[model samples]
Target chain A: GAGVSQTPSNKVTEKGKYVELRCDPISGHTALYWYRQSLGQGPEFLIYFQGTGAADDSGLPNDRFFAVRPEGSVSTLKIQRTERGDSAVYLCASSPDRVNEQFFGPGTRLTVL
Target chain B: AQSVTQLDSHVSVSEGTPVLLRCNYSSSYSPSLFWYVQHPNKGLQLLLKYTSAATLVKGINGFEAEFKKSETSFHLTKPSAHMSDAAEYFCVVRLERGGNQFYFGTGTSLTVIP
Candidate 1:
């Protein structure tokens, strides 16, 4: 079975531009999560989805960052007016249940210039 | 607040030698602890997890970790180090009451010299 996957393995964009990163969770996974890994640091929680609705989004840095998981399978992390500070590896993960271990994706490296 | 702390930023060992990666966690409630390995340009792979079951947990590639409530630690260990084990390792903690958000440690880079 195919594991979780992220599209556009690498993306370089100018600052202040809008960027969207997509994630495809494993089949039958009901809980999805998004994380950002800065250079030399660990991944920080971004947002989480249970089914089609976001159950927790407190990890989102600011209002410019938003995510949606329509249909409960595919998710997209949208960054408006991207900043250079936003440059990092965007990782997505999914689990069968909320308390289970999550399987992670290869991640999309977004670089804001 | 639930958080993890990896004691070392980097560790190097010779092949066939023992490997140890230390991690300590802080949480208000009984937490779920996990160890994940990340190779270059690859996704994070689960090494093992401790969910209040048996204290000694074994995982893939001959890796294991012991959850110690007394020490507040869940350190990863292996009897023999393999060259293929070189990578970044992360320790994670998740509280039972929270909304399934995982708190991660900075990470420890392991290097195996053949």
Candidate 2:
């Protein structure tokens, strides 16, 4: 079975540029989540989607960060005017339901210069 | 608000020795607790979870955690450490009322010495 996967294992972009990271959750999993992990830190929640709607997005750091899951299986995280502080590993995870255990995907490491 | 606290930032142990990683959680209700491990350059893997089932929960890789409601703690432990057990471990908590929001601890780096 294919596990949750994220494209562009690594990405480097200049500050003030825009970047998009994609995530494909596990088959049949209805809950998708995004988290950011800085060096020596645990993953911090960013956003979560249940089915086609965003169930919660309070963890998004600022207005520049946004995410969408239009089709309910794939998700995209968009960042505008990227800052060097945004350099970190962006992890995606999915679960069968809201209270179920989540399975994580290999994160996309974004390096903003 | 729900939160988790990992007492140790780093713990070192030799092979065949007992391993203990302390974690304490604070929640307004009976929370769902979990332990996750991440190797270098790999995604986080769920070690185990406790969701109002038994006080003692067993997870993969011979790991286990005991949920103490009175103490508000869910600490991970292993009888004997292995070199492969060296990784970053995180304690997570999920609130009962929140919108399935999971909170993570700072993480503890386990270093296994042979």
Candidate 3:
């Protein structure tokens, strides 16, 4: 029934540019999460949102990374001044609640040149 | 600090052979363990999860994992490997506390040779 989905399957941008990745979680999912996966590596946690407010942002790599989930359904991950190191697949996941297993999106591949 | 460790970075097996993917984890509290598979250009799919329910958990597509608390391991195994089973597998551990953040292990890439 419509799993988690991410927009802009692939994105390319120059260094120092800004980029935004979008995610639409499954219906009725109250927990949303963002993760970054580098080449040949597993996904690393970035942030988590419970409803409209972010419950945890400690996994965000730096200040340049920010995410928001307004109205509790759609989420946007924003990166300011993108860097070559930021080149990776950004994944989004959602769950019915914090204790349940998560459903993941196809992910948005971001490349910073 | 909750963390997961995948014992093998790559595993190759011929079709119809047994398959095993090893994983170990460390967490301060009782954790929820999961196995996920990612096919090329596809999203990560849950193979199974162990939430202190039972030692053995069966998942979709003939996959199963056993959680061993004494050894701190949750290993995935399949009786006979299928060609479609080739993919990247990740072991994850989630702490019950600390916002329930999931910690992922380095993935193990499986190669099924027919």
How do the residues A1-113 of candidate 3 rate in per-residue lDDT, one tens digit apiece?
88899999999999999999999999999999999999999999999999999999999999999999989999999999999999999999999999999999999999999
Question: What would the per-residue lDDT of candidate 2 be over residues A55-105, giving only the tens digit for each residue?
Answer: 999999999999999999999999999999999999999999998899999
Candidate 1 collision pairs: none
Per-model DockQ:
0.92, 0.91, 0.91
- Local error of candidate 3 at residue B71 (angstroms): 0.2
lDDT of 1 at B71: 91
TM-score of each: 0.98, 0.98, 0.98
Tens-digit per-residue lDDT, A39-107, candidate 1: 999999999999999999999999999999989999999999999999999999999999989999999
Q: Among all windows of ten consecutive residues in candidate 2 chain B, which has the lowest summed lDDT?
A: B94-103
Model 2 lDDT per residue over B1-114, tens place: 448999999999999999999999988888999999999988899999999999999999999999999999899999999999999999999888658789999999999999
Worst 10 residues of 1 chain B by lDDT: B93-102
- Fraction of native Cα contacts kept in each candidate? 0.89, 0.89, 0.89
Model 2: which docking level applies?
A: high
Candidate 1: DockQ? 0.92
Off by over 4 Å in 1: none
